[model samples]
Target: MTSTDHDTAPADRTAAGTAPAPAAPARRPRRELAAATVGSVVEAYDWTIYGILAPYFAEQLFPGSSPTAKLLAAYLGFALGFLVRPLGSVLIGRLTDTRGRRYGLTLTVSLIAVGSLLLAVVPGYASIGLAAPLLVVAARLVQGLSVGAENPSVAAYVTETAPGRHRYFYSAVSYGGVVLGSALSFIVLSVLLGVFGESGIENGAWRYGFLFGALLGLTALWIRRGAQESAVFTAAAPGADPAPGPDGAPGKPGGTGGTGPAGAKRAKAPSPWPVLRAHLRRLTVVFAITSGATTAFYFVTVDFPSYAEGTGAATKEESSAALLLGMVALLLAMLGGGRVADRFGALPVLRVGFAGLALGTVPLVLAMSSGRVPVQLVPAVLLFLLGLPLAVSNVFAGQLFPPAVRAVAVGLPTAVAISLFGGTFPMLAELLRSAGHNDWVPWWPAITAAAALAASWGVREHPLPGEPHA
Candidate 1:
């Protein structure tokens, strides 16, 4: 075959007997990619910082007789953020679908910054009485909304902007930003602990972490403002391109075209509900895919440190150090997995990730229980496994739906699953431990992973129009 023919082969294979695929965009979306990555980092940092610093500030924020009660109240506030995520997903997802990804991203980042600022400055219970905890919860709710909107917007933007052949690799880089952000939180916390001591942290040194996150969010917002809108979104947008006629020719404006006066008479932007309802199975697939990974992720990254400290497997400092190391492992694993998925395919990689989680959980927990393994070792391994599927997970979801409802299709179900599984994980684990059911905690992620593994079998990737198959 000629060079041109060879170049077209992948698209031909994807299209089978259908019309030739559209040409890929000539210019690479480097700026867009960078902006998306930065946004993910800022969003993650702001979201996870609260969890990391909660123990230090919990007593200060809530009036409680015991440390456990105070910590539980703080975690309940964390879960409150998850509870409102679906609303954020719906509101922001619709805005993203109707307005633009750039707009949605900017708005979400702005909210994140505001929430972080609120958390940083809110008066402790000593100064404000009941108002302190109420304000903290309110701030978490705001942050929850931003996070709910941010994930799907970033996923959709990255998926649409990435070069078709290296989409998974690009996704890996985006996910790595999240790991990096989480690691940054740990690093900042560690520094605070070092500078101020644990007693000082409890006395209010934790607010600096949130203040730093707020500044980072502003930086991400500025970066996102300069990003170009996704070409796919542009093409799919009403009136942006002439609608196709019955025979595949471009339809005339205001006639058969789905734009201009006649189309405007019809609808402004397409509603996500109909599309979402039509793709109920795909929505379920998104939920199932997210369930295990999100649960395992929160458990490993957010809860494990406290669990370890409580169990005497590690001190607070040691657990923090281990978590930081685990974040590094996670970042590396995501990048590697993304590359491998690009070379092979996402489904196989996802299967392997879920399977590993399902099979490894029991042993990992047993090792933690036995106290034979180093504290860092188990978390690093667990997070590494979690990162593999997470790297490609959003891209996989983006592939399931058309651009019209892509953000909502991916976001809502994901937010719901996270709220139910991931957001509740830390609080649930603590409660279970208190209730003498600590051993049952490991099975939650294992069971969810098994479900995701089963769901992965039924998922297939479809490249966007004008893109080559990986």
Candidate 2:
């Protein structure tokens, strides 16, 4: 029996009247994976809320604002929040290592709750002038900080909790959360549109969406609070915390000392800087490639919707409907993409998706610009193609590093790429069109394809807790 199972063994004595009775079967890894996936989905709902509400906020909070300028500003603020994620990963990763995964997740979820609530009630530009936009910016900052460390903590938790052979399968659920969350956002917005119509959607109805986001976060917090710390974490040496360093040292205070399986502790813990110094080469490679994925995702998901709707080629309602349709297609693709990755490996799947996106980007942009029957179908087609890379990258990125530095590895790379590439993609696209280069819009996807191929080649799938690397 496992150590955990033995802990709960019956006290009945054996024939010698000295030993304890046998223990029950251990709770299987599948069950643990389920819990982790549910938690991830809940967390994603909160993170995606801002993206769904951005257009409306731009209309209300920045009336008469240029759609391009307004969307750019809002995303810039959103990107700013991503900028702080490395800090969150370091802090939360340290906490997870020192205290427990449960503690870190609880803290992150709580912060999301507070940020969502603040956004829901923040006054509009008309009511508070510059202060309104400032408040929205502040709320995003808080949310970014909370979400920054979320991926690392969740990935670490799932990897440790799952059985070896099923590690990839279980981790796929984490990416599934993104699809599920974005799909729900579209559904929710669709319903809101029906209830409020166009004017209502632009009016105060959008604020309620933020409240809804907060509610989802609170629900996630409540559900996760009941989960115990992972056995992987609890098994750390006397004081080994799993907080990730830039390198693989035990993070900050309470990091795992150089403890061996025999339970012997080293004279001193390794410093974070030494760990970082040693691993900079591999780390940079991983970061560069992974960041590209994040940029592609941001370009496709965050900016593209606004670009499509704001193009003046389509009415606001039509654009919203198309966006809603696109997300539905994306959700389905995301769910299926994970299984494909598990079967084929992340690199192949990612390479295919990225290449498809690059080639498809032009057709997709042309369709959006065409304003014809076939062109309208572009959202669904593009969503599916984009969904492929998104699903593979999300699941595999966490697998690139060992537990010691997983959080920092995942969070920082994503933050940097997203901030630089995804954040500016939409603005750049709009600028290109304004500069009389609309024909080059297809190049965006082409660039994404090249980046994806390079990054996929760079990733090294390591041995998981329960299985050998492929």
Compare the candidates by lDDT and give the number of the best one: 1
Error of model 2, residue 332, in angstroms: 3.8
Candidate with best TM-score:
1
Cα lDDT tens digits, model 2, 45-86, are: 666667767767775665445776776677566667766776
Model 2 regions more than 4 Å off: 1-25, 28-31, 59-72, 237-270, 309-316, 323-325, 371-376, 430-442, 460-466
Q: For candidate 1, lDDT tens digit of each residue in 318-381?
A: 8879888888888888889888888888887788889999999878877886887878888888
Candidate 1's C-alpha runs over 4 A off are 1-28, 241-267, 461-470
TM-score versus the correct structure, for each prediction: 0.88, 0.80
Question: Using alpha carbons, what is the TM-score of model 2?
Answer: 0.80
